[model samples]
Target: MSFTDSSKKSDPANPKDGSSSESEKPSNEKQPTKTRGQNKKLDRSSKPKTPLPQKMDEEDLGICIQITEKLSNSVYAFGFRSPPDPTDEDGQSYLSATESPMDFQTLLNKLNTEGYRTVNEWKNDMNLIFDNAFNYFAPKTMRYDSAIKLKDKFTDLCQMFTKSEEERWMIKIEKLCNKYISADNEQ
Candidate 1:
C-alpha cells in the first residue's frame, strides 16, 4: 500500500500567520519566573497530548504486509481471519466472550487505510488478535493451540523488523532532541 506524505505540518494551534493569540502575547503584568524543570513541564504541556500518525516507510510497510499475508495464508488462520458472524451460535458466543475482538482481515484493512501511526500500534493490534483468541478458548482447545502457534510465528517473524524499527525510532528521536537543543541554545 502506498503511504501518504509523512512530512511534518505546522500545528494550527501555533499559527504561522504572524498573528499571535491573546494567550500567546506577553502580558504587561509581571509573571512569576519558572524553574528549568517547570519550563520543561510547561513546554511539554503546551504540545498536543496525542501523537500524530507517522506514515510507515516503504520497507517497514512491506514487512508488515508480509507478516499479515503469512498469518492469513496459514491453515490455523481460518477462524481468526475475520470477525465472527453474530447470527451464528458459535459466533454469538465468541462475541460475548471477547471484550476487544481483533482479526487478521481487520488488521489488513487498517494497514490499507493507513490507520496505524507506528509499528507499535500495528503490533499491539496484532497481539490483540491472538490475545482475544487465547482468552476466549480453553488452553487445551484446538483454537487456543492455533492461536499460540500463530502468536509464536508472529513473534519470530517480527524480531528483525522490530529491531530495525527500534533503531530508526531512536535515530529520529535523537535528531529531534538535537533540533530542540539547538533551538533552545539560540533563544
Candidate 2:
C-alpha cells in the first residue's frame, strides 16, 4: 500500500470535519522558520555528545586498521589471486619459465604482455598505490583481519618506496604502476 503523510489527514478528535487541528496544520501552511538555536523541542546542543571520529586526524593510526577491514571485502569483490611469497625469489618464475633465458626482467615484462592489465592505464593511480601494494604482498590464503595487517605493512613499504625517490629505482615502479591499467587498450 502507498504511504500517506499523517499531517495531511484531519484530526481524529473531530472525524466529520476534514480540517487538521491548530497543532497539526497541513504542511503547506507557513510556520515560522526556527533559527539555529531557537527550537526548544530538539535541543541539539543539549543532546548526549559522542566523540567524533572526524576529530581524530591522519595521526590516528587506529583508524587505518579499521578501514583495512572494509578494504579487504572491496579487494575481494574485484576478484584477486594472491602473489607468490616475496621471500620466494623464484616463486613467480613460472610466468617467465617458458622462455629459454628466464630472468627477473622477464617476469616484470610479463605485466606488459597481452592479457595482462594494471589497475589503471591512462594515468598513475596514486590513490590506490597502497591497495595494490597490499594486495601484492598479502598471502593467498588469508582472511580479512590477517589481510588487513599485511595491507598495513605493504602501505608502509609503499611510503618508503615513495620517500626513497631515486630515479634509477623508480623506473620499475613506474612500469608496474602504469602496466595492466585498462584491458580495452592493451598497452
Q: TM-scores for all candidates?
A: 0.61, 0.19
lDDT of 1 by residue, 1-187 (tens): 1123566665547657455565676569988999768765445677778766578665567789899989989998988998889999999888877777789999999888888877778899999988887777889899999999999999999985756657979976897899999999999
Query: Each model's C-alpha lDDT?
Result: 0.83, 0.39
> For candidate 2, lDDT tens digit of each residue in 1-187?
1122356655667746676557654567688899987876765988788743422222223333333334434544222233334366554442233212222222223332421232222012222333443434445544334445544654553442243336635765676666756553784
Model 1 collision count: 0
Name the 10 consecutive residues with the lowest summed lDDT in model 1.
Answer: 1-10
Where is model 1 more than 4 Å wrong at Cα? 1-50, 164-187
Question: In candidate 2, which residue ranges exceed 4 Å CA deviation?
Answer: 1-142, 164-187
Best by TM-score: 1
